[model samples]
Target: MMIRSALAGLALALTFLMTAAPVSAQTVRVGIVIPQSGQFKLLGDHVRQAFEVWNAGNPGVFSDVVEGDDGCTEQSGKDAAAAMAEAGVDIVVGFLCTETLAAALPLLTAEGIPVMTLTVRADIIAEEAARLGWKFFRLAPRAGSEADIAADAIFRLWADQPFALIEDGAISGRELVEAIRIQLENRGLKPTFVDNYRPGQATQPSLMRRLKSAGVSRVFVGGERADLAVIAYEADYQSVPLKFMGGDALNAPEGENPIPEGTIAVLAAAATSGPEDQAARDAFAGHGLIAEGLRIPAYAAAEIIGAAATRMTYGETSLQDLLGQTTFSTALGPVTFEPDGERREPGFVLAILEDGSFRRLSIEDTAALAGDSN
Candidate 1:
């Protein structure tokens, strides 16, 4: 009878141990929703590569990647958000364009899942945060900032030169042009011309003629990859002798090499493999991923999520609590969020085409460019 009682007690203890042992901390699944197939495909590829590298470093952290075909469209974004919510993703990252992000914002915020957005449009993220609180965090700079940077770079490079502004109707493009216009006006300078063009138009011959007729020596353009390529190619074809300046979209990995000569682009500095970005790079490389610009934000997003998860007492932590009061060192720089969820970092860089490759231009600062052309 005694032996039987001891056996029963041992069995009970074993059962309790089995039940309480933490189950290897089930995979922290992250869902990436972006345009896997569409006009923004190259940007999507960059984001995907960054996530892949980060995931490779930390094996088994991601259970799976749920592809959201948000082709920068409202319908696609809504569908993708619903699918991700239905699939029960712990976190969702990547909405590169503003339109898609706007579409999915309501759904994702309502579900209470934290989203790390790579879209650069400030207004969309700001408006969404105003409506939804800390559920959305942006990793990219605002359109106004990019435009200001571009204006400063151009003014410094070619002081007292008549310039023109062109855009391709992207939200980033329109806002950037406006910002550049504001900067030019602040310096008592005015653009020779300002106009918007439809995307993928065969040639901007008429616009090119107007720019040349206005005797514009410098031009600032705000557009995505294809638009930049088209404008550059058209300018070359039209023999427009103006120097071209652009925003971050022109720095895209896919379209970098094709930019015509005499074109300078302002872009986010690529995160280099140095002491600062090394550990995170290693973490991402361990997963067979190459951490690049914009992608670094994705890895940082994962790190943020992981750190927050570690601090939670089992299921007690909420996404809001985790994101509301957390900071992490990212490849871009130290990332801390305001109540509005915008990253507080001075993160843009100006790159000029030197011998067919884009290289960073050394500018003192945006504000210091008044009356000086570097």
Candidate 2:
């Protein structure tokens, strides 16, 4: 009788072990770095939300997230990287700002942790990440794409109409406006008026008067949304026919139309909502979050990372090979990045704000553009 009892106990223990074994491997470990607090917290929140949305419907088991808040600062970024490195996570994702990402690179690379960044910094591939041979990937298009997208839209709308370019005294603003200038010059048209606007000052009366007096009908703005809004408002207040065109920075202008009703924009957003996106958008709305901008890009990045993670778990491939060789089907569409981490597809879009939302204008086919991409 004692012998029989011993055998039964062993059977029960084996059954328990079998059940718990699969459960223990269900959640993969991953480290997430984002600005959970500070100036960029809203964008960070959207990143987290996008990951959660992707996790809900993806085929992988799940990931146990170890979060690090970079707060869009260099010190915070290092601290966040140190925390994640200490956690012994297999991979690190996020780092949505240049300041934080730049600071954290050495730390992450020292530990041989793969990083998938959501921020668009061209210098990463061209200079730092490439030189170091670090396993870092940028999931967004290069900043230069904003210029190409904006120029394409402007060329379509006013190839004949003389336009003016204005910028604030910021590096990003200068780059944006200079892109417009280069594109215009390439097409044999020089801007009639080129000037700079003060970023935060409430009054642009003198600047507005100058543009109007110059008889400029269209103005391309490369500055803060609030500043452009003030300019647009002043133009309307004085009955000036100046219309503003710009990149996605214009989307942040609060309250109402910051530019004229027919103003055009080159949006950074790659994903346009479709039937497949309804569930995610609805889920986001249910939680009082808007799934836009960084959200969609984050979702696409998570999809790529999740798929690679799953394969890595199965020992089928490594993250480096998967990232370099594969094309991911994202909510935006099929995406493949060049060796230099530039996205190898049509990455920019043109849209006009209508009835409080961006209504995209039909342009060249993305597939054709991708085919012709250098």
Candidate 3:
């Protein structure tokens, strides 16, 4: 009885709560499986707002949608996908967190729903998808993409400085640091120190001491921003003039700007740009969800799905095959996935925190370095 009632609730929600009026014929039933609640609730709001913009386009080929919140938790992720499957969605998208999509994959596979998740777990599409014979597409950068861009930016900004690499001992962090280290070594340059430290420790003065002893003036950190900030504080106490840099984790919310000014980070998602960008942001804000961070990517996801819907041949067209065959034009420009379902175009830019805000560092005309531009 409980399960039946739950299905009825989900069905009603999908049928009515989706939009104010009934969608026209040939509407695509999309299941948006993202965290609508939990620690990642803000990301949920951004995605919802972006989807609403996509929904506003007339007879927008996508509808009958159901939403599920994994709260960035595993069990919730599986349950959410299962619930959406029961609600009769044809496709699933928007798994922002890694664990969320991973937990939901088996259920989605069993239901024969193809998922195009918005995450950076390249291994899923790179290895697991083929191994398990599950159709999963990743709309974000592969894990290695982060390191690739970071290395390029580092070389552009401080090619001659003595540098160090640090990680938090987590798989993600370790992989990121090692990727950069290898790329640097390939260029015949090596980092001054490669260090791994436990996360959430009270202090890391000892690590700071070691780095200072090595005459390391530039750092590439592959872990939590809080830890980076802690490193900055300890460096200051040790009177070591150093610049701290890292991947996307540098901008992660950690209560406040823990790292000192001039610290840099590389992020995959860029800010919305131009008139089209403003229109999306306006539409996103109009929906009551504050737009930021992941909003552009969310909008890009909507555009990709909507474009794919245009090519769907109701009875005969295979969605999974079409996805691999077509190129999607997104807010981030044209997006085409590699065979492993990773985005084909990958790059990173340098951004430094200045005056309480992060700004892009243009290395185009950098006069402080060698002419390594290609």
Residue-pair clashes per candidate: 8, 0, 0
Clashing pairs in 1: 53-284, 53-289, 56-286, 56-287, 57-286, 57-287, 156-373, 156-374
Candidate 1 runs further than 4 Å off: 1-28, 35-49, 59-79, 86-88, 96-100, 120-122, 132-134, 155-159, 168-174, 192-215, 223-241, 252-262, 270-295, 310-318, 363-374
lDDT of 1 by residue, 1-374 (tens): 02234588797777778787774344556788877776778768777777676666666656787777767778887888898898888778887777778778788888877777876556556766777664787766655566667777666666667777888887767878988888878997777789888877766777777777888867787887666666767777887766678877776655432666546777775533334567777766676666765567666666666665555555665656666677766666666766787766645777666676676654443334333443
Q: Specify the highest-lDDT model's number.
A: 3
Q: Judged by TM-score, which candidate is best?
A: 2
**TM-score for candidate 2, residues paired by index:** 0.80
Q: Could you tell me which residue pairs clash in candidate 3? A: none
TM-score of 1: 0.69
CA lDDT, every model vs. true structure:
0.70, 0.72, 0.73
Better of 1 and 3 by TM-score: 3
- lDDT by residue (78-166, candidate 3, tens digit) is 88888888988878877787777778877898888888876545555457776786767777767777888888777766677788999
Tens digits of lDDT, candidate 2, 1-374: 02234588797777777766633223456788887777888878888888787777664545577888867788987998899889987778888878878788788889877778877456545367777766677777667778877776666566556678899989989988898789868987688889998888766898988998888888889987778778888888888877677777776736443455656677765534554356557666766778786887777777777766555544455666777788887665677866655567656667666665665655443333223321
Model 3: CA > 4 A from native: 1-26, 69-78, 96-100, 120-122, 198-204, 254-258, 270-277, 313-317, 363-374
After TM-score superposition, what is the CA distance of residue 85 in candidate 1 from its true location, in Å?
A: 3.8
